[model samples]
Target chain A: MNRLYHYPLSPFSRKVRLSLAEKRIEVELVEERFWEQDADFLRRNPAGKVPVLKMGNRLMAESSAICEYLEETHPTPSLLPSDADGRYEVRRLVAWFDDKFNSEVTNKLMGERVFRKIMGTGYPDSANVKAGSKAIKYHLDYMHWLLDQRRWLAGNELSLADFAAAAHLSCLDYVSDVDWNRSVIVKDWYAKIKSRPAFRSILADQISGFPQPSHYSDLDF
Target chain B: MNRLYHYPLSPFSRKVRLSLAEKRIEVELVEERFWEQDADFLRRNPAGKVPVLKMGNRLMAESSAICEYLEETHPTPSLLPSDADGRYEVRRLVAWFDDKFNSEVTNKLMGERVFRKIMGTGYPDSANVKAGSKAIKYHLDYMHWLLDQRRWLAGNELSLADFAAAAHLSCLDYVSDVDWNRSVIVKDWYAKIKSRPAFRSILADQISGFPQPSHYSDLDF
Candidate 1:
């Protein structure tokens, strides 16, 4: 069986899990405290990041690359659009979330509130938390602006963009960092994606130090 | 004709330029001081990053996404491999260079030594430069290890992975940061890539403040 070595709170790992579940690919989930730098895990992935998929003879790292591999290997319910332009939009948004939003928001809020505690790094820097809080409002507004024009984050159809976004937002929501009431359209967008069967595994994720909020798994939320 | 909004020093932008040149796509280069956050550049790309490709009616951001777009729309001289596994390895290495290697090496050395002065940020941080210099030897050795086994960075064929690695190395080479004497195989690999016609524009790049080192444009060094 395929195995995905991932951390529960890692948005990148969650992105891969959502893609796998969305595609109905069967994989045993193995939680990895990747920062420990275990010799075995390092052997599995030299990059030393999570969401490393062990499939048959191949060990894959890099969430985007692994996601693309899944897309190519299993083309049943395609996450990418048919046209080049549409696919570009999807990949662009994926980068936006994984790179830009990640550095500004997720690394700020989650890195401060959750990771420091879990990893035993140090105390949470309230400054970064404040910045992350402020930054998230902007991101939420951006999402609202996007959702106002299109059905999903990228376009009319659900794409990897949606999964990439939902992955981050859901993790933030797990810690109650997200203000769901910020925008009705964004909330509605979340409602649509959150209720999907692919979200079940993520919703059930239990991190040792951090407890999930009640509304996180709520379809009505 | 297409146009690319790029900063000469940005590895991401350089990566796109290489893909365009290799694929024989005609794109007018527009140098963007993206960090200034100009309203017009932001309008072109909300992310406010360089190497925004204006192709026909569409304006695109994110270099990796743009490269994939170019590859998809123009597939003749494919930078990506044919098989799914080969393609995955290519993307993985591309991400490796762009993400891990970038944060560890490129951003540290180039960001401190070059961008700080150019952007008027402050004096170069010696600690970071030291760390970057130290990290680069390991990266070159890793490259040497890979090249010893395979012809190119990713595999037997030239790939976007090569372009990605070259883009970062070239920028570092501009500041005389790359120790070519460290690895003969890696130096040979650079020699082969540096001699390509696609590298001409990159070779000719003249940043406002930083003069190009003699070795930067040299096909034989």
Candidate 2:
């Protein structure tokens, strides 16, 4: 059986899990504390990141690459469009969430509030938390702007862009960092995606120190 | 004419530039001070980042997405492999350089040594420089290990992974940050890639304050 070495709160891990569950691939989830840098884990992935999928002898790292690889191998419910332009938009948004949104929002918010405590880094920097809080409103507004134009983040159809976004947002939502009332369309979009069966594993995820918020798993939320 | 808004020292911009040049896609280079976040530039790309590609009416952002789109539309000199696994490796290495290498090395070294002066941010943080300098050796060793196995960074074929690695290394090379004496195989890999026609424009790049180092454009180096 395929085994996925991932952490509960890692957005990257959640992104891969969503793709796997969406594609109906069976994989045993093995929770890995990747930051500890276990020798065995390093052997599997020298990059030393989470969401390493052990498929047979092949070990895959990098969430975007893994998601793209999964889409290529399993084409059932395609996450990317056939057209180049459509595909570009999907990948673009995926980068937006993973790179821009992550650095600006998730890293600031989650990195301060959660990872600091979990990783035993130090006390949370209130200034970073403040910045992250401010940054998230802009991101939510950006999402609202995008959702106003299209049914999904990338297009009318659900794609990996949605998963990439939901992955980050879900992790933020786990810490109650997300303000769901920010945008109705954004909220509705979340509601639609959060209700999907693919999101069950993520919703069920429970980090030891961090308790899952009730609204996080609520379909109506 | 196709236009690319880019900053000379940005690895992300250089990656796109290399991809375009490798694929022989003509684009008029427009040096954008994206950090300034000019209203017009933001209109072009809300992300306010450099390396935005304007092809006809379509404006594209995110270097990885742009490169993938270029590969899709212009398949003549393929930067990616035809097979899924090969493509996965290429993307993985690309991310390895872009994400891991950037954070560990480039952002620390270049962010301090170059960007500080160029952007007028502040003085170089010595601790960051020390950490970046220390971190690069490990990356070079990793590269040496990979090159020992395959002809190129990803595989035998010269893929985008090589460009991604070269792009960062080239920028660091401009600042004399790369220690060529570290690994012969890695140096040889750089020599091969540096001699490419696609690398000519990058080699020719002359930043205002930071004069191009003697070895930067030296093919024999």
Candidate 3:
């Protein structure tokens, strides 16, 4: 059976999970505290990161790569667009969320607020938390603007870009970091994505100590 | 005509440049001080980073995305493997270099040693430089181990993975931060990749304040 080694709050892992569910590919989910850097986990993925997928004999690391691999092999219900330009836009936004938005917001807010406590690192850095809080508003505004222009994050088609973004935003929502009322359009966009069958597992995700917010799993939320 | 807004020492810029040259795509190179976050550059890429590619009317950001676009549009000298699994490996290694190796090595060393002075970001952090220097050895060893198995960074065939690895390493090489003598196998691998026609522009790169090291352009090095 296909297996996914992931953490409940890891946006990267969540991105892959959304893709897998959207494609209807069943995979056994195994929780891994990747930061501990266990030798066995290192053997599975030298990168020592989560969302390591084991498909029969093949073991894959890197969320974006894994997503692309799934797209290439599965091809059904494609997460990427058919055209090159469309594909570029999708990948670009994926990088934006996973790289830029992630570092500026997710890593700051969630990394400090949730990850630090869970990983036994230390208390949340107030400075980082403040910056993340400020940065998130701009991100929400940006998303609002995009949702206003297009139906989905990248375009009319719901691409991996949406999954990439929703992955990060959902993680923050788990810790009650996102302000749903900040942008009506952005909120509407999230509400639409969150209602998808693919998002069920994510809504069901229960991180220890940090219980899911009442609204996190609500379809009407 | 196609144009690329880039900076000499930016690995992300170098990666796209290499792919463009390899694909023989003629493009006007425009040096963009992206950190300054010019309003026009922001309009081009809201992410506010370097290596933005303009292909006719379509403007593109993100190095890997640009490379993939180039591969799809111009498949003559293909940068990706034909097989799904092979392509996955190439992308995995590309992420390993562009994301993992980049933050751990390239960004740390270059961000401190070269960019700090060029961007006028104050003095290099001795701690980050020290950590980057220490981390690169393990990376080189890892590369050596990989090279011991496959002919190229990802596999037997040359792909974007090679360009991605070389792009970051070349940026560090510019600052004279890479210890090329650390691993003979890795050194041999670099020598081979460094000799490619696609590498001409990278080898010729010279930052204004910091002249290219004597060995940077030397094929025999």
Pairs with steric clashes in candidate 1? none
* CAPRI-style docking class of model 3 based on DockQ: high
Q: Which has the better lDDT: candidate 2, or candidate 3?
A: 2
For residues B1-221, write the lDDT of model 1, one tens digit per residue: 99999999999999999999999999999999988999999999988888899988889999999999999999979999999999999999999999999999999999998889888999999999999999998899989989999999999999999999999999999889999999999999999999999999999999878888888898888
lDDT of 3: 0.92
Cα error, residue B148 of model 2, in Å, equals 0.5
Candidate 2, B184: how far from true, in Å?
1.0
DockQ of each: 0.95, 0.91, 0.90
For model 2, residues A186-212, the per-residue Cα lDDT tens digits are 999999999999989888888898778
Question: How would the docking of model 2 be graded?
Answer: high
Every model's TM-score: 0.99, 0.99, 0.99
Q: How many backbone clashes does candidate 2 have?
A: 0
Model 1 TM-score on a 0 to 1 scale: 0.99
Instruction: For candidate 3, write residues B1-221 as lDDT tens digits.
Output: 99999999888899999899998999999999888999999999999998999987888998888888899999979999999999999999999998889889887898888788878889999999998999999999999999999999889988999999999999888878888888889999999989999899889887798988898888888
Off by over 4 Å in 1: none
lDDT of 3 by residue, A1-221 (tens): 99999999999999999999999999999999999999999999999999899999999999999999999999999999999889988999999999999999999999999889988998989999999999999999998888899999999999999999999999999988999999889988999999999999999999889877898898787
Backbone-clash count (model 1): 0
Model 2 Cα shift for residue B169 (angstroms): 0.2
Candidate 3 global TM-score:
0.99
